[model samples]
Target chain A: MIEFFNVLLVIFLILSALAVERTKDLLSAVIIFGAYSFMMAVVWLLLRSPDVALTEAAIGAGVTTLLFVGLVSRTRRWE
Target chain B: MNDIIVKTVTRIMVPFIQMYGIFVILNGHISPGGGFAGGALIGVSLILYTLVFGVGAAEKKFSHRLGDLSESGGILIYLVIGSVGIVSGGYFLTNLDAGFLKGEAGALLSGGMIPLLMVAIGIKVTSTIITLFHAMIEEDPS
Candidate 1:
């Protein structure tokens, strides 16, 4: 069951990564990238590195998304 | 941004998020989460406030001068603590050898200077994030 969950997370991670890159709307891309970061954090937890998972979730998923959104608002939204 | 629900939720949530961040920072030596993660959490709470409230209000709460002071003071505290090790005729940040109380293993007060260092890091990271966010959002001078 854990393996299945991990696999699902990985699949979602891949999809989010691709979606972030392909999305023309920069704000949407940033949101998708946040999801990618969140999935990656869970993957880190599954790999038994809770420390890395915490950092990834806080910095990658949270701060980076906010910073990107700020950038998007400051500049153009569409790529 | 003008939604009352969002404002109310953020107002209620920020304190708890900050408390959790402090918990993580204080327990960094014994726990999975440390300074950076905890600081980021605190920073996020502040950023959420800034997003919900106007920048003007957030700045009133956490002024730029305060952020600058904390950012520099955090590193200064770290440096002062590290210098204690050197002053005691040991390497920089020499922890146990620097005569800090080790306390009991798995205890909150254990690990000597490590907890202090984590606090310093937390302060630095939190202020840096806030400063960076404010800087990025500030109006263009040109």
Candidate 2:
């Protein structure tokens, strides 16, 4: 059960990363990046390190996404 | 940004999120969470507020001067806690030897300087995140 979820998460992470890179809309890419980080956080939690999971979820998914969104808003969107 | 749902939810959730962050920070010695996680959670709550509201309102809640003072104050608190050991003729960061009140092992106040250090780290991390967010979002001079 856990292994299945792990595999699913890893696959989702790869898909999210690819989507982020291939997306032309910067906002979508940023959101995809956030999804990737969230998947990573889940992976960390499954690995039994809640500390790293918490930091990853908060900083990676939260702060980094916000910063990226702000930057995207400041700059061009279709790039 | 003007969504009423987001604003209302954020307003309702920020206090609970902050309380949980403090709980994590305080329970660092006895639990899985420590300063970094707790502080980041707190920072996230504030950022959520910023996202729902505006940067101006967020700044009003946590001003630049307050952030700066907290950034320095956290490290200063850490330094002072460490220097206590030296003042007591022990090595830097000496816990028990520094005469700190070490309660029972599983208690909240048991770890002595550890909780204090976690608090300092929490403050520093929270301030750093807020400061970075503000810096990134600020208007360009050019």
Query: Which candidate's TM-score is highest?
Result: 1
For every candidate, C-alpha RMSD to the true structure in Å: 1.2, 1.5
Docking verdict class for candidate 2? medium
- Which candidate number would show the highest lDDT if scored against the true structure? 1
The per-model DockQ list reads: 0.78, 0.65
lDDT of 2 by residue, B98-120 (tens): 99998999988798899999999
Task: Give me the runs in candidate 2 sitting further than 4 Å from their true place.
Answer: none
- Clashes per prediction? 0, 0
lDDT of each residue in B20-56, candidate 1, tens digit only: 9999999999999988889999999999888889799
Per-residue alpha-carbon lDDT of candidate 1 for residues A1-79, written as tens digits (9 for 90 to 100): 9999988998898888889779999989999998899889989999999999999999999999999988888898888
Worst 10 residues of 2 chain B by lDDT: B133-142
